[model samples]
Target: MAIESYRLNVAEVIEETADAKSIVFDVPADLQAIFAYTPGQFLTVAVPSDQTGLAARCYSLSSSPHSGRHQITVKRTVDGYASNWICDNLKPGDRLRVLPPGGIFTPKDLNVDLLLFGGGSGITPVISIARTALEKGSGKVVLFYANRDETSVIFARELTELAGEHPSRFTVVHWLESVQGLPSLEGLSLFASYFGGYTSFVCGPAPFMKAVTTALKELGVPRELRHQEKFVSLGGNPFGDVEEVLAAQATLAEADDADEPDETEQPAAPAFAGPVAIEVELDGSHYSFDDWTGDKVLLEFLESKGVDAPFSCREGNCSSCACIVLEGEVSMKHNDVLDAEDLADGIRLTCQALPLSDKIRISYNG
Candidate 1:
């Protein structure tokens, strides 16, 4: 059987709010015949840069399927490559290659009242749900949009218009942090009083998300009613700075096979000439190899050197061989892990990892 993908024609582009733009696409006659999506599901957009094939990024649809137009809102981030490209280059009538919608962020039923919270650009998916709920006559809806300032608030005008049109059905509040320095929940409390009770959907960056969710719980909100949508998954403490753990593992590995060393243990390592490990330490195991190998990734070189590195989706999809770079640098052919903060702190996905220096130290955390 052949795999399926969705390619779309950009029909319109609307400037939703400052720093955010909404792109509407026509579901091609051929693809629309097979395309169906849940309200909160996200689509991965494949954008090719230079001569290389393409790089993909997932963005949530901001428009309701009931609206008769399929659209997604993208907020330009200062340092993000894909986001910046989309904002500056994408225009009306441009073509976009897309994957079918996939995500479990949408709420199933609309039996109860809903409280929706959106921080900055995270308003995209929440907007979709709120609109869908209204169209389906799904009880009362309250929306709280929090942002750095009014200047950067996305969908502000439309939200305001929506509130005016559905005065009794929906309530909208804007929380300005730049001028107000953290909003007092006086507005939200007033809305809650009208609804009796409601389920909450929240979305935003790490700090913003953590704060809102924490506040909801502390204010005696029920956990069952709270639904959160997060794009990046920083898997627990295992992947965080754990160089000491890697060093300890290397120590154990060294002790185990030091007495009866492998063929490349002594000197003049090997002849493959890929990402050579000048030094290796993990779980008390020590295996040293050489550098200067062409077209071989660090993880590949480690396997060739007889070090069983735990990894999956070597293209950098699963973040399986994610590790802390204790010393030296590595070049990645591609990666989804290691954001700006992680990269500054020297974390890398070992699958796409390539040695930039002759000597490098890594940990499996396996």
Candidate 2:
């Protein structure tokens, strides 16, 4: 829903690899409940700017809830200026703006067969999931992690130690692309014997996910058994709400014919022109916006009107901006977070959804 940010101090910074590090937060006692999260959730960190302006990025929590500490592992992106900034500068005692844990990429049932597929830094949440599973000791935790080589793998040592500690319950497989080829359908299929009954959680770059899932489906892995998370921001919003919305002159476009979705990063929001009647209900308070449109997301529009609505990435990558449509219909530019069942339940993303009608009402307190 309307997620709020918290200022937490870095308590520890441990290097997980040559380019990746895990930052543990000193969460206040009063706010510990706010930060309590499921095994595969993530935290959105907002870094203040000196010359670059403010930058916000989401990092998955690598620590299990049983650890009673908040830790997120970040792998420095070679071309990502913000990532590079975090890797080079963020340290213990540094105060940073971080949103509470948020994400739906968690194990549905721990008692069932649990397998995780991660590539590169995507190992963060799966690591958490794996540890939590091992701690529970009721299910088997299997992880197939891929990286360039042993040198670049984050949490390489810790994961191995975990496997050793829980030899019977946990199994960790490493795919060093340097020795073997990059993760492919064939590479993934080799693990097929482990598939049919296991509930698979996959996260990585778009191609890796697509290739793996496609192969799984072809191998007869049921659709309901597989879950995926596209960790990057797919630009210009995602088609979140109504697939078919009123276009110019009120013409309807074919929902099934929408353009192929591109997977990460993005363009800026467009400004809305019309005088729109916007009513938002949050925390038992009501607010209104006079000018809003499909040009900009409801989150941006509300911010411009001084509503201080919740949001992280303006793209539909996370559930920070999720809201329930109360009175009118809206559509998102892109939607990877909410599925058909969620939409059917009236849940939608306010950061990506824009009002197609003149009057719209939404609530974030859900």
Candidate 3:
């Protein structure tokens, strides 16, 4: 079962800044539905690599879903393989292998007021959210974008034009580190106080994200209202056949599971021994299965049942397969995205989840 991927033609390339470029894809009408994405979701691209055959990378889409365009902004990193490859090589009419849109860094409700913070290249997804919310949603949008300097701002003209077109509902505050120094905790807290009621989304360098999340927490903002996106390089090639990738991953997972626990660490609970049952809710539909044998992970089991479960980077490194546990319990073999707060809210990565109880109920509605 190979994951579906498409070869899309590059329709255009726009130089956003000295080190950034936006690649627009020309998705065919037949694949339109498969590529359709919510604002802030990302596309996984397979960049050519001599050493590894191809290097898979996830890039956030900057174009709004309503815009009928698939675009991803890439900024050159000092020694980045994929980013540099994309910026240096891609051109109009070039074809690239790309996975369908996937990711959970999106606003659930466009009608809610949005407080957005984007630092440098992090603006990629934030702009998508702002554009979609402004055009298709009835809510005010406030953007706090930070950059190294004015010249490094990626979408200066477009952002200015958007602000001008939606003057009453859209506002943007530009922060240049060269001019104002790096944004401090106190300053970020003061700014966020003005929109305490709005749903906040932060994507940036690590320090910037930490400051914003800390500020939101200090303001007593609920966990549900605070969202942040963390960028990590994929360790495996997701463009490979899915079964091959899963087989390799299972070998590593088994090796890890065989290791003895450290004396200081608490022992994990035993897994459910017999066949299990599960009830799931997704896209307003209900499904139940009574034959889960506890041998396969949740996502794999669901796929075996012909359930169209949402997933990307099935290695548990992304949140596209996150689901909330409604009843019973499950354990994750590996997780890199969800935090303590997310786990407290019953959010589990379905790709890594294994049965811990006889019966479980989960929902992808959230």
Candidate 4:
């Protein structure tokens, strides 16, 4: 049978760090009977909302399949809907609709040296891979975990013990962002060095990954040797304030205005008609909604029909509502998730998508 999204009951909640929590889910019998996943994939969790709060968010699995339970670690991001809600309201026995694990972050082979870097809550999948690699004795591993302070570090003791037990095969380094006079990497093997023989993996918030990748590039690390995982939709803007956002947007606008448009631009059309049939497939079922004049987006249509579709940041910044257009063409009013290749391949974010054709079919299961 084809796999589809299923609702898992929250069985236990464990506080992993100061502001982070790990939630274990009770897998249903049918799902458990056939469920299989790699180490670094993620599951999209849908938290029911009153149509006001932000929608569902995706969290990577912190625990590997070896643990025999599905678990996700969430950091309480400032103004994060799913993260904050899971921390505050979600308790044992609560049910959450969870999409199956999906992504390409998992290690493809285990015969090479692994260099892992994580910051704050981004340690989830890094730890999972390290643990599994060590257990299998697949390769040598080094982990660099950075956080605000020692107390904010999640899985500190466990990671320390793992490194201690496998001194020659494993190494763990901790960096406290709040600590001044921290040790410099003059003598130590910093990730920037590429360390001679290592397949580097990095996961963190966007800025952290960018800095690390920049350093890695400066160190002459080959692109294939470096692997980075970034959560697309950040919970909060670390830069802060609407003024900064507007300023940045102005800069982008200036840049775009300076660019020359292609001569192949299509002529602008008049107003679009509606009451079109927008068909979508979720979990093998087809849902059709009448697209009225006011209904301009696929997400709005889905929500209006009470489809319980997974989403986050209805502004189209997150791929939580990403789907493939299996049959018809749709125009994006706005989208930040898909790259050029994805758009060429017909993947679109339903949040910012509008049907150009009267008939459309989008599948979130893809």
Candidate 5:
């Protein structure tokens, strides 16, 4: 079935933290079936920029599937155009355009041990995954969450209560910057006891996630056992905000598949030189974008053409915008999601890709 977007009415707005807020949406009875989702999926919401609040951005759903109302949390960004706007201006009774829940960051099976890691607001999805795992009797779930200070931590009380409720199944350790700063290399040794037998899921700002990724690496955790989730549009940092280390982690799959970049042949990141024609396939429908030159990325261009497609994190950090290129060449300015195997199979990030050749063929249903 084709994934669809709907305008769900805001039911309530709850302040989760000093800078963070969760907006509950009133999903109609008719839309509930489509809105139903797994543990770690996210919603891409379009809150209008002006009075109507019609602009869009992706936010991770903080409320669990067990919760009645569907809600996504937002941390007010300093100069965040979309996040700050939504925090200050959006409220209950207002309508926002929303894409149904979708994302790849979820618990795969029950037999594996689980170790979850989150930094700052990145805890949103982590909590969802952890909560669901506990309910299902998934093997021991442990979390190492990082934050700048006590107050900055999202879901702090809920996490503690959850831990108290399921002491045998779950454990949460907080790393506060004011006390000890980010988790350190020395700290990785302390968690080494659980290192060999767990699947590590890490999410947060680039630097924080990289440190977690590195700690996992030093602990001898295998690559396949690690899942990395990065927030591009962070509160202090805006979308597409990434550091060299974090960017490398996002592309690590690509790098590992190839293993080594030819020292002499390192390639510059690619981009579409100019406007080009594109063909798109969504659901079972086909559309040609002759009107859209190469002015914008593929997803934005298609949306402008009135095509209902699935996309989130316009920053290219998530697989929400991933598509398979059927023909011709396409270039991506930045990518932290798809790996080399994906590229080998023709997968590309439509949010970062621009049509390179005069014409390009792509499939969004992929």
Candidate 6:
């Protein structure tokens, strides 16, 4: 089934920094529930493109869910097409096609003390998480935000205001690379050591994220307590008709399989041949099906059954469609985001999952 997209009016635009802008969408009341998102989730926008008709890009929401606003901050990248287009062309009264909120980068419990690290535009989601936690929960929030310089900091004023409002529970530590060279692994580890017990979330440039994650690992932070968001470009247009998207994806997968060498030492398990029985738990509801013929991916099958499973980039490059296998195994056609630890934890992307067992059970509660 084709994922639904909505046209939202650009309610306002705020110039955050020299190269960053925040676009607030005016979601109609009828669609408000569909657009309601948790902090750290993102919206996929269908940007107009002459070469491809439309370019789909995901932008993290910078507005707290409790603020009754749908806002996404976009920072101009050196040669980024979508970011540049959004920063230059979007204005009040303009309508843009956008997908509903989707992502797994949110905190399960708002009351848990959080230690957040953000770099450059990655501060967008971190601020949202911070704001929501401060306004709705009773926990401390510490943000270590890094920027090129003071002038390049997005949400500098807002963060200051939040700190002022919740001085006892919120703190902001700004790191300017111009003043103090790029953060070293030793420095990061030392700083993170102070908040050893807090749940840690990191989002930043590749190098920055690498340093922070490595530091966290060396600090012996449990895998469950450390989270990182990776920014990756979608390889396919998810705004297109669902059938067409799936067909194109299948062709691409076939080509990839043909060109890649088998790297696994052991032989792969054979796919289950008979009709399978599947069970899924999502959004506090349980669903079961007895005749899953294994003809389509799990997300496609769930949508066909009227289950509103979450998904963003169906290309397995994002964790929006992630679900945990509880009782049976499923094979992924492709995966770019999940690490070995995640797979060991049974986290599979529903968008690329195919049944490998006659009876399967999964849950999206996590």
- The best candidate by lDDT is 3
* TM-score quality measure for candidate 6: 0.91
Regions of model 1 farther than 4 Å from truth: 1-3, 184-196, 233-366
lDDT of 5 by residue, 1-366 (tens): 113468788899988888888899999999998898776778876554442223446687777787766878889778777888877877889987777787767667745778888888888888888887777656888988888998898888888998998888889988899999667766854774565778888888877776777777777777668777656541111122223335565476666768665452323345556567778887799998665455677777887788876655555566777778998877776676765646877988876777778778888665
> Tens digits of per-residue lDDT for model 4 on 153-197?
999988988988888899987878887333234312364474665
lDDT of 3 by residue, 185-267 (tens): 99999999999799999999999999999999999999989888887778677777643635776677769978766443333
Q: Which ten residues in a row have the lowest lDDT in candidate 3?
A: 262-271
lDDT of 6 at 249: 60
Off by over 4 Å in 4: 1-3, 52-54, 180-191, 234-366
Whole-model alpha-carbon lDDT for candidate 2: 0.76
Query: Residue 153 deviation, candidate 5, in Å?
Result: 2.1
Q: Number of clashes in model 2?
A: 10
Any residue pairs clashing in model 4, and if so which? Answer: 275-291
Top-TM-score structure, candidate number: 3
Better of 4 and 5 by TM-score: 5
The true-versus-predicted C-alpha distance at residue 123 of model 6, in Å, is 0.6
TM-score of each: 0.61, 0.72, 0.92, 0.64, 0.69, 0.91
- RMSD, every candidate, angstroms: 14.9, 9.6, 3.6, 10.6, 10.6, 3.5
Off by over 4 Å in 3: 242-270
lDDT of 5: 0.73
Model 3 error, position 318 (Å): 1.4
Query: Looking at candidate 1, what is the lDDT of residue 70?
Result: 80
Number of colliding residue pairs in model 4: 1
Model 1 TM-score is 0.61
